[model samples]
Target: MCRCIRLQALIGLLFLIFMVPEFKAKAQVETIASQRQLFVDDFLVDQLERAELEMHRPVDEGIAFNLDKLWEGKFSLYTTIIKDGGTYRAYYRGLPDVKEGNDRELTCYAESKDGINWYKPNLGIHEINGSKDNNVILVDNQLTHNFSPFLDTNPNAKKSERYKALAGKKVTGLYALTSADGIHWVKMQEEPVLKEGNLDSQNVSFWSSSENKYLVYFRTVDSGFRSVSRASSTDFNSWDQGVEMKYGPTPLEHLYTQQTSPYFRAPQVYLAIGGRFMPNKQVVSDEQAAIMGIDPNYYKACSDAFLMSSRGGNNYNRYFMESFIRPGIGLNNWVSRTNYPALNIVQTGDTEMSIYVNHDYAQTTAHLRRYSMRLDGFASLSAGYAGGEMLTKPFVFDGSALELNYSTSAAGEIFIELLDEKGNKIPGFSKEECQPIIGNELERTVYWNKNTDVSKLIGKPVRMKIYLKDADIYSFRFY
Candidate 1:
């Protein structure tokens, strides 16, 4: 068997064995309703339906190759998909333009209303490097940074104070970017927030359920291998250096790569990572090392992706590809042999997720492609249900309403409720559950159509207590 097949099979088995529970709740099982606990019927709802990627281009025709500029003279290495106010913003790395060399790397900006059709922001926003036109934020090569924008309503909340962004050269040092709004950031003075500790910080994120910080899968320089690194932080600036999570593809193996980004609506704490293959070792080198040396007949390479979870950020589980139907490249060769994920994956609505990426072939500029999908069986499960555990760690809130996502497998009746911090259902909302379109996937949205007064619960600390015995939860968003 090919090494790719073997690696994939191993990952699949690992996820099924440890995380997902093959539960047999009998058809006639009694509904167990408790005071602190509530029950929804066992209805299967396709919350997230993986959709085929659609391409968007800044240029008129053909692919727009290259990353968005987060800094001047820099390429966008990692991106955080964010919806600022009404407009959608893809805040990404403005990695140094290699054609210009390291000394000139900087951060830049881009904006879009629809996730597609991005426009480079001409806000005339100034940068750290005294650049006014290039849209460059920082132009210094001594400290390279990327991926630090996070969404938080309460600017003064200390618990929500972790300033995050990837910095350093190949040695990505974790740093902090502080902003009153999601835009207009100021790099924290006491930076190197996460120093060159034991683990290399590649990409960073936090789970809402646990209200904690996390670092994405990484490769150790020593082994030249990649894997997930786990850590905890109250403030984004500092981290409790963590353990390396083991699962799925590794960089050392032939083209095996995995990554993490936010999931749309299932649970606020949900995160997805994927695995892909890197056939040639030289891709990591300065030049196109493998392309210049490797024989074409040797490797059948394709990018593979996966998913993982963390409540408070300190702990994590390795994800696996558990589909009975094997995954293969379906369309466009734009993503072929690519190094960075095009655009950041977005949580469109509850359970609806689409990872936006761009690729430039020998065509025009570059086109953007969205990889969308929904996970069924998420509702019947709780936070980390695969592990038979919910984020029961008493979510301490800054008075943010918990955004809930619900979907059904077969067309059936479903009811939901708002539970106070004390776990009692609030009054005046829809008492009877409402049914949305059955089976089809619903994106990052709640059944707000049913409950007209969703506002009453907005400013309070509450959880969108979903009572679908048979519904699937794609994700939840907590303020």
Candidate 2:
């Protein structure tokens, strides 16, 4: 009887050990550095203790350029600006009298010294309006609809190809063009590098340092609405067929242009501010269009820019459905395809960044306008006066101190606590030991108990818990 009781007890113990609930060990974290992470959403979030998402809007500074020049009018689109060394270069399509084919469209160029004021430099490279006094770069070619260029940053790039461009219409496919000085462009290859997958969109490419190759973000259609796709190349001539991007459980919508490019501060997190097109969502009436001196056909569809992001692969995270940019209170901007954003966001001021948008399309006073926002201030993780907390996912970073781009009210405060991989609060870096952070800064080092260095925990898998009270954190990085 004693042996039977002992055997029954052993069986029960084994059963409980094998089948009962058990705590699992924590998963190891990735060792990649989190230098510049955007506040798109809970992409790296592990938990939230009453915090919420906040969206930031840009302030329209003024009209960047008037498209009243030769061969340029309200039909211009796809504006790309680059801060090359000290000089700024702006490129766009110029179509004064829209007809058809390459004869009607021309590639226009502009230059800005400080990005606040712009000038149309007469390169005298291409003839337009029966004269070379215009700012035309390339004419009588297939780059008119979408001639997107990037200042090639590849360390191994040739001097002749310092500026690379991709231009093509839908029927002809995408052609590779290279420039020695961005004024005079020539075909790098004789044939189309990519085709058959909706090449009608602005096919923009860049030499990615992360992948050590050329990356392209073009357009496609998802269930009849415009969507995005991506491709890659080694020598800018040969490219693999792109894979359509997936927006992770978010229902599809009409996204006309997906301006997916590497963020200036954080290249790893690609910023995609695209035009969310509403085909017939007209806010402007026919009489109102005429009264405002707007084109009738231009008031059909309306669009507003939305925020999206990607790490590298063919995927986008549209965290906030709210509009990043809205067509403000004006009849000119309410017209269709007027509020389309430019290709890139350029740093114009010490604490400000500017994004250009095409406004008043198809009107006599059509022009490109500038919108400004704080550096790295697209969206923020915010909290009210009542206070809230947020915990980040486990990550391994190589830095001694933490910095933040944040803003707060005079009475608001922020606190930080570094936690172990298992989410347990570390001994010396607990919230109780943290000092109240107060100020609006682009880069402010966070301190705990008067200690700014965390080099001892640099390579270890750890997480951070941020506490906020009427504060907004735009970005966080360890360096």
Q: What is the TM-score of each predicted model, taking all chains together?
A: 0.53, 0.93
For residue 307, what is the lDDT in candidate 1?
Answer: 40
lDDT of 1 by residue, 1-479 (tens): 69999999999888876776553222221111111111121121212122111112111232222353434322334445666546676654454334322455455556766555667755566544464555444444534344445554234454334333444534445556565545455567545565543332234554343243444333343255544455555555566765565433422332133345444333333344433434443222323324433223322343433344443243443322331112334222312333234323454445444455433211122234455544332223332222111222123233223333444555332345555544455564433443332343433333544543355454354433444334445443443
Where does candidate 2 clash, by residue pair?
none
Off by over 4 Å in 1: 1-76, 95-101, 126-131, 142-145, 153-166, 170-172, 197-201, 211-224, 248-264, 281-304, 310-319, 322-339, 342-344, 347-352, 361-367, 374-479
lDDT of each: 0.41, 0.84
Error of 2 at 91 (Å): 0.5
Write down the worst ten-residue block by lDDT for model 1. Answer: 30-39
- Residue 178 displacement in candidate 1 (angstroms): 1.2
Clashes of each: 84, 0
What are the runs in model 2 whose C-alpha is more than 4 Å off? 1-22, 25-28, 99-102
